[model samples]
Target: MNNFLAHTFTKKAFEQLASIRNQYSVSIYLPMYKKGKELNEGLGQSNLKSCLKKVHAVLVEYGYDKSSVNDYLKPIRNLIFELSFWRNPSEGLAIFLDKDKGMRCYKLPFPFEIKTYVADHFYLFPLLPLFHNNGIYYLLELSRDYVKLYKGSRNNFRDIPIKKIIPKQLEEVVGFDFEQKMLQYRTGHMMYPAGSFHGQGEGKEDEKKELLSFFRKINRGVTKMISDKKAPLILACTDELYPVYKKINSYHKLWDTNLSGDPEFKGTNELHKASWSLIQYYFETKKREKLAKFISKFHTSLTTCQLSEIIPAAVKGKIDTLFVQQKEDVFGTYNSAKGCLILDSYKEMRNISLLNMAAINTFLQGGNVYFLEAEEMPVKNIPMNALLRF
Candidate 1:
């Protein structure tokens, strides 16, 4: 039996979802319990059944006959009985399907509010957290005898094999000569020592020089492996080795803080937890800065809480940062040719979530999209806000 559930969701996947342009695309999101009684009792299966019912009703409203609707949703219907899928679930589930494309299901690491959206495009705002500055990072665990690399996100972390491109140890770069050189070095008094060699300062300098050569080799392979040079790289190593590696580190986004320990003993989960704690401050500060910029420019042409103005600007690629209230939907139809937006009081056959439109447009244009609670929104009572690029 094929599990049919995907555990990893990437930016590429999000882009694929955005690029889909089917008239009857269905997107369903549901929070799932990772363990305990809820999962044991098959609550996720029942929740999915409820969402399927809603989707069927919407498809019927779109003028699909009962037989066609059943055929269209057959893939999703099968999931309700896929026992293995419910047994190993993530914090949330997102399902996207259409008559032509069939279905794609992802077991996401974060929870979502129960939502069923059928529109011309997928409802993607719930997945914004995965792309925030807090989104993806690389961890390079360095030591004299060990080297490992990992790709990490908020709730997922796994080792990335580097043996093919990177040396597994200093000896791989320096050869057996490293053992002979090690005899000359001695630990210094500092808690995180940068060692000394036989009472001579030159010994410490030679050690630094050797480590610099080793790290430069590692940096070359790391740079080659990481295609996204802008993605932050966190170094997990002793305090002493940080400065040595920094001298030759060519990666522009290498984080300023080091994990500050013998990384060889720590598991991926522990490293992910510690690295996230260090880098989260960076994302928070960035969010604060954007909010402050919006507040400073509020009431001017540079900022807006108006959905009508925001929608057109988004289409034209004018948005710089967008803040949207979570669990809120603004249903409307937009005609790009006429630059018209019609807001409906309720969900209609032709209308889609205007907020989704704005968010996806802004994202595709290299703008930031942030989902905030009502209280966290920059302006009170507004469901959407934007900081314009202009």
Candidate 2:
């Protein structure tokens, strides 16, 4: 009741809408928030009857027919009918069709509100623990990319993500904020805790299932949207979970790497040292060509923390990728963070400047980190290892 279902259309529709935008020689100026927009009666030709009919056909074809759509679409439908009256395209009437859906019309002039699903194609998922503090008092590490992050004040929700990116690759590349359909990771959603190492407590099947199902559904839906549309996949999890998460998705869980519950790793101090060595190995062997090829090259793999640390080393700047049961903070140059680089640091590394390389930075760098799975964080678990090639 709080939010509407049709609101979901905002995300997909905006993406589809853009495909047809250039046809009108018009540029869309989306808002960062709900600033009250001006509703243009028609975004198509006056003689839009033919267009409406075609759109209707598409709606019927797509699954929105009778089963999915509602009984009332008065305003939206009439807006389509009004299109047929326009004569020229200059009146800004054309390029109005986006995927030909059952709901052809919408609450027009949707001011560019950045929160939730208000932006043309922007969506936000709140913060999740990815890594934790390394000291006695454990605190989670938080990181985000392609998002508008606004830090809340005292007593306010800290690390709350207000916007999530679900736009087309083209829009994302050009820096377009399209807040459309918004989703959240709810409680009992299958997550491995902030820094969980055990899968389900001794008697937590029901609890685990509830959480797992949620994560699975989201993962399935999200991966598809991201893969097909080449959209950005924003993840917020625990630092310990990241390595295990990566291993499950890709990477060989080699016993030789000594990630098992070994007796030697009975404490945090030992585990952090081991994990640090593993990371050091990767950084030491990193290659410039492999990373440089994608530096600002415009590609999809750029979003995941999978390639998180590579670029940080490339710039030879300070980068804190996260180590041990608790999250550790590292300070370094901010240049690459502007784009084609890594995370931001508190202490500017002696060899680097935290200067903005541009204005945008990559989402995977570890300084501002989070967890993905718990096993990767063992008392002596060195779960993740960065890969480097000659």
Which one wins on TM-score? 1
| Candidate 2 lDDT tens digits, 243-349 | 44344331122112333332222343333344444333333222232234324332343321232454444244233232212222222433454644344544221
Model 2 misplaced stretches (Cα beyond 4 Å): 1-202, 227-234, 240-390
Predicted structure 2: clash tally: 59
Question: Which residue ranges in model 1 land beyond 4 Å of their true spot?
Answer: 1-5, 134-136, 153-158, 173-216, 219-226, 247-253, 284-286, 335-340
lDDT of 1 by residue, 1-390 (tens): 222458887788889889998888999999888899998888888899999999999989987787888878888999899787788888999999976678889999888889998887889878878887566678999998899988876778888989779988877877798877675543333222442223446656666677777888999999898866667899999887887788788899989989999998987778989998887776677788999999999889999998889999999999999999987889988898998888998777778888888998998899999888999999988989999999
> Cα deviation in Å at residue 244, candidate 1?
4.3
lDDT of each: 0.85, 0.28
TM-score of each: 0.83, 0.18
Q: What is the C-alpha RMSD of each candidate to the true structure, in Å?
A: 3.8, 24.3
Steric collisions counted per model: 0, 59
lDDT value for candidate 2? 0.28
